[model samples]
Target: MNHLEYVTCGTCSRLITIDVDAAGIIRNLSFLGGCSGNLKGICALAIGKPATEIKNTLKGITCGSKDTSCPDQLATALEQMGY
Candidate 1:
């Protein structure tokens, strides 16, 4: 598995750490310093999903007019991982 930890930029969350396989399927995911329930839900949705799929689904999401959100930051992090 490939592992990466990312510090989110311009989002509510401060950090995201993840593990994925060669196929880009998520093995684990976690967030720090965000809306607890929502972040947990995001983690649930993300685990076992392809990083590319998650990135595509979440890349443009925004929070309350902010240009980026936790989800969007995840997408960016996935991209940084070369998804």
Candidate 2:
């Protein structure tokens, strides 16, 4: 299975690291330097989840009504893998 690591920008959530298996499924996820609630929710939502589902679910999620968000960063990471 493949692995990946990434960080999210904007909002109060500063960073996140996630490891996804070759099938684009999340095996693990961790949040660092971010707002507790948002980060916690992200981690929970990611674990054992497919990247495509996550990407679709989080698409266009604006952080506090802003332009970017942690979920978007996760989507970018998966898309970079050619999802």
Candidate 3:
């Protein structure tokens, strides 16, 4: 397993951390300084899912009129990490 942590930009959240296996399946996930309940739910749903799948599912999400969202940031982060 490998651990990845990312500092988000242009969003209410400050951080996103995840644990992924060799095949890019998420083992764990966490976020700091965001909508608490929603983030926790995102983390829970993301666990054990493939990073690529998550990224594709979340990549274009927007928070109101903002160009990006917490979920979008996660996708960007995972892409940067080569997931």
lDDT of 2 by residue, 1-83 (tens): 66666656675655566677877788887766767786788878788889888888887777777897777777776776566
Using TM-score, give the best candidate's number.
Answer: 1
Q: What is the TM-score of each candidate against the true structure?
A: 0.96, 0.79, 0.94
Best by lDDT: 1
Error of 3 at 77 (Å): 1.1
lDDT of 3 at 58: 93
**C-alpha RMSD of candidate 1:** 0.7
Worst window of 10 by summed lDDT in candidate 3: 74-83
Deviation (Å) of 10 in candidate 3: 0.7
**Position 48, candidate 1: lDDT:** 92
Encode model 3's per-residue lDDT on 32-66: one tens digit a residue: 99899989999888898999999999998999889
Question: What lDDT does each candidate get?
Answer: 0.94, 0.73, 0.90
Model 3's alpha-carbon lDDT is 0.90
lDDT of 3 at 11: 91
Clashing pairs in 2: none
